[model samples]
Target: MSHAPVFDAVIHAPGRLQICAILSSVDDAEFAMIRDAIKVSDSVLSKHLKQLEEAGYVKLTKQAENGRQRTWIALTPAGRKTFAAHVAELQRLAALTAPEPMGQGFAG
Candidate 1:
């Protein structure tokens, strides 16, 4: 199903957008993996995640692996839906500004 286009400032930020993009395709992603994918420092990723969490768009879980604690991240259902809508809106707006087809705008 197609989602209605809607602009979401929270999800639109560069780091957050990248996080959402990564999370959108997976059931859950490891914290380090996401940080690596986005090429951000741990603190930066943490900050971005905090904002997303506050917005109710992401969920964080901790699990024990071996002797270390690993954190996993996933997008909430609301996040998935909202992200889809935001992407649709971006596409819609992009299409509006896209150049006309070759020769379509020619006056000659």
Candidate 2:
């Protein structure tokens, strides 16, 4: 069986998208690391994280690390699958929109 790729709007925003990209590459990442990598303010990142969390696309955990509270973020199984499908859909769209050879498609 085959199905069309799924595009997740929740993960489509630039910041959220970048967050998913980073999380997809690892089992987990520190919230600070993600914030720095995405170069967004705490409130902005927090807002995006809240949205993603509401969509059940990400999991957040807070714990003590070296006498400091650290927050870690990771994609849920659903998140990973949705993100993969979203990427595939984007690739498909790019392929469909790619320019063809000049003057090669018209018939006289």
Candidate 3:
């Protein structure tokens, strides 16, 4: 949403980053699907999710399907905005460290 770049410590964690990246592209994702995509244990994923939830970055929904309660996760509007900003900030920072073009530094 063209938000100002921000460094979000909560989303900066690798696991959480992956989670956000995955969720950012989808309308909603299942808990097990995310867990498998990120290759983390249930508890590990839950921990990361709780952190995002605490920050109001994600919304979790529980539904009954075939007598099983399925949990679906999605990023809140704020989360999407912040994630975009955080990614932008990271891009900006990475650009700062980019190497100079070949021969640009050489005074021929």
Candidate 4:
């Protein structure tokens, strides 16, 4: 039987998916850190983050440290679980799509 592709929507977008992956690996990170990790412009990251936050996938907290303002980002428990499942599904898709050795399938 054939299997449908996983991560069809939210986790499929390149930028957002990258953001989710980065957040999944860390406990909590600052805006600058997440922006740098994703290598996206400030405005771009902000827009994407806002969407994630609204969807209840991420939490953002603004605080002051040593008189400096900082915005910290973290994945909620639900977000973590979703991201983990998305990643696993993507992995399975990759493995299934990979080219097999000779005699694996009919030639064109």
TM-score of 4: 0.79
**What is the Cα-based lDDT of residue 58 in candidate 4?**
90
For residues 1-108, write the lDDT of model 4, one tens digit per residue: 133334636656787788888888888889999899889999998998887888788999999999999999999987777777777787887887858778888768
Query: Residue 97 of candidate 1: its Cα lDDT?
Result: 100
Model 2 C-alpha lDDT per residue in residues 1-108, reported as the tens digit of each score: 144688788999999999999999999999999999999998999999999999999999999989999999999998888888899888888888869788789786
Q: What is the lDDT of every predicted structure here?
A: 0.96, 0.92, 0.97, 0.81
Model 2 error, position 90 (Å): 0.4
Every model's TM-score: 0.89, 0.86, 0.90, 0.79
Scored against the true structure, residue 80 in model 4 reaches a CA lDDT of 76
Better of 2 and 4 by TM-score: 2
The deviation in Å at residue 93 for candidate 1 is 0.8
Worst 10 residues of 1 by lDDT: 98-107
Q: In lDDT terms, how accurate is model 2?
A: 0.92
Model 2 / residue 81 / CA error / Å: 0.5
Query: Which is the winner by lDDT between candidate 1 and candidate 3?
Result: 3
Pairs with steric clashes in candidate 2: none
Q: State, as a TM-score between 0 and 1, how close model 1 is to the true structure.
A: 0.89
Ten-residue stretch with the least lDDT total in model 2: 1-10
List, residue by residue over 29-59, the lDDT tens digit for candidate 1: 9999999999999999999999999999999
